[model samples]
Target: MKTYDEKHIRNIVLLGAAKSGKTTLCETMLFEAGIISRRGTVEEGNTVSDYHDVEHERGSSVYATCLHTEWRDYKINIIDTPGLEDFIGEIISSIRVCDTALLLLNAQHGVEVGTEQIWDYVDKYQKPTILAVNQLDTEQANFSRTVEEARRVFGSAVTVMQYPVDQGPGFNSVIDLLKMTMYRFPENGGKPEKLPIPDSEKEQAERLHNELVEKAAENDDTLMEQYFEKGSLDEDEMRQGLKIGMLKHHVFPVFCLSALHNMGSGRLMGFIDNVAPAAIDMPAEQAEDGSPIPCDPSASPVLFVFKTLQEPHIGRLSFFKVLAGEIKAGVELYSEKGNTVERLNQLFITDGRNRHPAEVLRAGDIGCTLKLKNTLTNHTLLADKQSGKQVKPIGFPTPKVRVAIEATNKADDEKLSEVLAELHMEDPTLEIEYNRELKQVILHGQGDLHLALTKWRLLNIYKMHVEFLPAKIPYRETIRKHAAATYRHKKQSGGAGQFGEVFITIEPYYDGMPPYREHPVRETEEIALNWGGKLVFNNCIVGGAIEARFLPSILKGVMEKMQEGPLTGSYVRDIRVSVYDGKMHPVDSNDISFKIAGMMAFRDAFHQAAPQLLEPVFDIDITAADTMAGDVMSELQSRRSIITGMDSQNGYQVIKARTPQAELDKLYAALRNVTQGKAKIKAVFAEYAPVPPELQKKLSEEYKGAELVA
Candidate 1:
């Protein structure tokens, strides 16, 4: 790989919604730059960026792929990111390392939900962005409609840098408004043909050109005055005005292209080369101490590891973006995470799956290092001790859904955690959690597909067969009334017999109120609530009803009964049990005897008291486009959700409600379908609420029905 000067390098990211032809755009750029012999299609699954087997099988990118291309004396390092909202982490990482985000919009689809999502990210990062209307050769391509949608959704800051001469099947050329000439592509894959603007599109092109000039003029008073007075400006003046607007985020130049057909690609390349900002123009990342490291090429090294790939034989491959200074092979850098100094080996510049050797990678360049110790994604690497500051990690969306997984084979059980740990390192959005109580390992991610990919990687790469199951809801049992009880244990199995006596009561507990019984209780009070009634125990055993050494065993027995609730067999809660009176034999009354006595006494008391099963409720935040607000509200109502309130979020209507967790098992897909793929919802486990009588009965019956299956 040949290194280019800092000024000549343009770190760009191609980000958009799924199936927006982002991969095709990268392929076209590579082909146009003479890097590829022919363009690869997504249908054929031979694209350079979507080289991964999972991506080809799914027909969408799962991870960001880095590709470098030379266009018109400028080096454009393009990072093609996955467009699915579930895989949005890739987009965030790619956008953070790039100076410009080329948001590719399918001309036919116009502004999609994923487009809105990426736009939000760009707005948050305050990065310079350009809109490229792709698929101009498609039958349904509408450039004007797409441009209008961009202006409507993204605001008036979006301006046209070039106007398409014709759209759809006739899209063979585009007229550069700034240069005032037409460039048409010939059938052969070679340089485009320059020609005069056709009379047919002259009026529309002129109107768009004037609008662009007006937008650029607003950024500068001199340019505005010149544009208004003379009705035109020279190339230098226009470029200056556009640059000011783009840097200030006032102008997002829109370009037209057919990435699949290789039409209008050269023109788009020229625009990126001339208009895209360099590292100097982008915002300099600051450390936690609020000090900015001059992002200049000569400044000290400050690199961020945005990605980590675990290769089978070669170990870990850490990819990072250099924000300041040039980095050479065998350089020592301080790792902020580990708080230790580490040395880099040979640097690898990436192009799809291929890695080219580079002696030194300059600032604003993205490269990989092989086998870095203790380096993980989102870790920072600083040059020396003085400027040892870390760049904050880019924010990613939290995983909303989870699935409990176990090894399908007993042999793979021990290696499951180890394999999942490596997968989690590769994708930070994935979370692996172990529920000790349930004895289940749960994997959490953005959606089902995200979890599926994680499992796929585990089985294919790590050779681990895993079984996926729905995570069990942690439920508890509590009581409503109070009652008292007593029990005695006597076992003569052999020479050492077991003898112990326990007296306790079960009672319902209120959070801030006194016990339900409100009776003057004795020292030993065991209160158990089964089916909503409380059992209270009072034993005034003067001397030694229970042995002092067996108190732990008595409590252990009581806890065992609590877990095996009286009514529903669920874990019991809010019940107070006290050991006030008991009897014991000197040698026979051991921990075992006391434990058995305590367990029996608690169970007996709990059954006497009433206990009930409590189900978990979740607070849901549903945000949908205005078009689907009514449908979402209706769906929530169907799920028996309590409507809390509603509001607006970034043009989408947000509905906050509370619903049962059981109703949300397969709701991810249902919500997507109802909202036409524009709604986003998040639900968190809230406080437990009592199930209705009828619903509780129905659920109990269903549980019994499932018992037959088991």
Candidate 2:
């Protein structure tokens, strides 16, 4: 490998819907660049980008793969990303670092749900894009319809740059509208031969060529004047205008390709090398404080780790892009996250599983380093503390689905925890949490497929078998009215027998207000209960019915009962205990006796206080097509959801609703089916509300049954 300046390096990412030929296009690109002697097919599972064992089994890419090739003295770094919505985290991370996104659209299906989902990210990053309508040789291929759909979905910025000469079955060549020439490839489809356009297709080619020239001219005032004065501009002038248009997102060139047959890919790569923007062409990197960091090889070294992987033999692989200066092996870099110096021991250029050693990587180049002490994904590394800068991290989407997990073998519990921790470090999107209130170990991820792959990895890679179960909802218990009860504790087990009597009143606590009662103000303290709400203790024992020193013991006993409520064994909250009257024996009423007395009295009062169960509710925001809005709302209503509001945004209906957490367990899957996998939904905890009496009765009975079985 040879070092190239920023201008000679091009960083591009391949993005599209699943099965849209992203992996096949990458294989063809590698073969066309002469980096590999032969190309591998997806069915064989031997492509350079999809080399992992799981990818082979699934016949699709599950992780982003880094690969590069040299063509005509220019080095192009390509990030091949997975297309499934389950692996969108990889797509987002890869797009964050690339200067250009080459979106591949299937000619048969055109702009699909997956394509729209990824386009959102591309638009978010504001990356210049080139659309390639692939799979032209398929039986249902329709290049014209795909282009029309692209224009409709992406606006008028999309312009046709190439048209297939003959599509389906006999697709063999394409007409380059920019060059106004026919590119005819051989039967085996290697290097295309440039030839004059046939008379039968000359008229349509000329019309498309004129449209291309006019679009190019509209990008620049000077080019527009040149076109107006001379009726047309030259190829160089048109390319210059197109570059400006692409940078400003005013132009999106569409090309035709059959990646499986290796036709028209060479020309696409040539155009990418010649016209696509370079890393230096993108906006300068920014620090956390919104200051620009120049991309200069002589300046201080700065690198941003965009992706991290756990390779079997190589350990942790940190993929990073050089933002400024140059990085070499044995260089000490400072990480703001660790606040310690880390020495880079080796730098390697990766192509899937293959690693090519490189001595130095210049600014604007992407490479990988093995085993950084503290550098993880999204961490920035600088040459010195004096630089004192960090790259803004990628904003990953929150997990939408979750499941409770338990180790199949009880002895592997600790091992599961350790492995889950390591996996979180490798991929931050996979979240593992122990819900203390619910008493379950929960694993959160993007969707069911994301969690399925994670479980497979745990069982196959780490040999830790685990079972997935439904996550328990963290319901709460509370009282609705005031009630009073009395309990006496008396034991005659020997000398110093326990004897204590307590009279306690229970009421619903609200916003730091003391219970409505008359009490002496001598000693009053507010105790913040751990289970939310407050406990106000007033030492109104004017006559010393119970000693003042025993107040703390009574409060402790109340808190202990709050941990496990009298109804369904859930945590209790928002309740005030008023111990206005009690009897105590001076010799026998110790802390233990008063505590037992307090617990019994509170339990009796709680039963008569109209106890209720409260379930958690979540705020849900759904974005779907207008045609599906009615169906979505109806389904939500069936799940006990309340429609809060609705509006229109970006050609889709934006719906806001509130529903119980338990109702949303399978809502995502249902939404996908209703919208044909085009809906985007987000949910967050809102508030807790009282459960219906019938449902509460069912839950109580289930709890009692479980206790009996135990």
Candidate 3:
């Protein structure tokens, strides 16, 4: 291995829809560069990028794989990312650290749902992109139609640099418009013979060449003048102009490739090596405070960990991109997130499963180190004294779908927690939370496949069997009217007697609007209840029927009862307790006596005050194709959703709605089925609304039946 300057390093991420030849293209690139002896196929399960056991079993990439190759004095660091939406986190993390995104499109299906999904990220990050219409060797490949689709969907900036001479089944050569030449490959398709353009295709080639020149010249004023004067640009001038256009996102050069058959990949790699933007060409990396951090090898070292992986035998592997200076083995690095310093003992550049020892990783290069105790994904690592400056963290999408999971064997409870913690470190997008109110362990993720794969890892890797169930909704109980009740707790045993009487009035509570009582003295004591509401106790007892010391005891009893509402065991909220009258026994009316009496009284009053169940509601933003927006809206209405608004966004219909959490249990699946898997949905907690009377009665009955069975 050799050290290369930031200008000589091209950090590229391969992105596309699943089964679109991303992994295969990466394999072919590695072989073409002579990094590997031979190419591996996804069907054979021997590709370098998709090396994980889960990937081999599924014949798809489940995680992003890092691989590098040396071509023509350039070191290309390629990140092959999974195209499945479930693993979108991997794509996001990879794109954050790379300088360019090579979006591979299946020639058979020019622009697919997955391709559109990834294109959004590329646009979000504003990365310089190159579109490679792959699978040109397939029987149904149509280069012209694919190009037209690309222009229509992506825009006219998608100008072709090469066109397949004979596509579909017999695809063997490509005409390079930039050089006005033809690259004719042999039957095996390794190295191509560069030849002059044929007389028959010269006119079409000239027309495309003129279009390419115009697109490139638009990036720079000087290039535009030269193009207008000469009506064209030479090869070197075109490459330079295209690089600037790519950096400015003014032009995206499209190439033709059949990755499986190794056709046109060599030429594609050459184009990338020559014209793709380098790390230094990218805008300066931003610090947390929105300041630029220049890529300088002489500056203090700062590395950003974007991904972490757990190998079966090699402990934890922390993948990072050096933002400043160079990092060497045995250097002490400080982590602001972990607030701990650890020595980097070993540095390794990985090619999927294979690890190559590297002496140093310079600025703007990506590498991995073994067993970073305090360093995890999204953590910024810097020199010991460099504390104030930190790289901005990657903003990952929030998990939309969630499920309740529990160990099949109760004995694996501790093991389940431990394994989940490990898995969370590996994939930070997998959120594990214990809902105390709901009494369920919820696992949140991008989709069902994301959670399903996590369960597979738990059972297969961790050897812990688990069950997935629908997560329990955290419903709340509240009162709608004022009411009063009394309860007397009396226990006359042989030794001692427990005697207490409580009279309490309950009313619906609204913040900033206290109960209207004559001569109201600002609430004697205000208690913030845990169940999403407040409890204001009014000590309105003018005559000393109960001791003031018993006030705290009574409030405690009310809180305990609020934890489990009388109707359906849900938490109670937004209620005021007015202990206007009560009686107590001086000998037995202690904290315990008042507490029991207050609990009984509040429970009795809550039932009589028109208690109603309030279910959680979420604001949902759905992005679907325009044609399916009506169907989506209708489906949402069936789920009891209130359509708040609708608009168009980026050619997709954006529907904003508020729906109960319980009704959205299977909304992700339904939306996918309705929209033909081309829709994206996001949901966030909005507010709590009263459940319908019929549904509330049904829930109460179900709870009662369960209690009786128990």
Highest lDDT: give the candidate number: 3
Runs in model 2 lying further than 4 Å from the true structure: 495-497, 512-515, 518-540
lDDT of each: 0.80, 0.88, 0.89
**How many clashes does the backbone of model 2 have?**
0
lDDT tens per residue, model 1, 113-182: 8898788888888888889999888899988899888988889898888877768777778888887788
Better of 1 and 2 by TM-score: 2
lDDT per residue for candidate 2 within 1-710, as digits (tens), equals 78889888999899999999999988998999998999999999889999989999999999999999888888989999998888888999999999889999999999987998899899888899999999999899999999988987788989899999889988888999988889998887879899999999999999999999999999999999999999998999988888888898989999889898889888888778888988888889888889998788898899999998888867989999999999888999999897778888999999999999989999999999989978898899999688788898888888988999999999999999999988888777889998887888999898898999999999889988899999988888999998889999999888889988888888888884644565554566677766665666555666888988887888777778888888888888888677888998878888988888888888899999999999999999999989999989988998889999999986889999998988997888888888878888889998889998999999989988988999
| Residue-wise C-alpha lDDT for candidate 3, range 479-527, written one tens digit per residue | 9999998999998887778888988888998888855584333346767
The lDDT of model 1 is 0.80
| Model 3 TM-score, all chains together | 0.97
Best by TM-score: 3
Determine which window of 10 residues in candidate 2 has minimal summed lDDT. 512-521
TM-score of 2: 0.95
Error of 2 at 321 (Å): 0.8
Q: Which ten residues in a row have the lowest lDDT in candidate 3?
A: 514-523
Task: Tell me the TM-score of each prediction against the true structure.
Answer: 0.90, 0.95, 0.97
Better of 1 and 3 by lDDT: 3
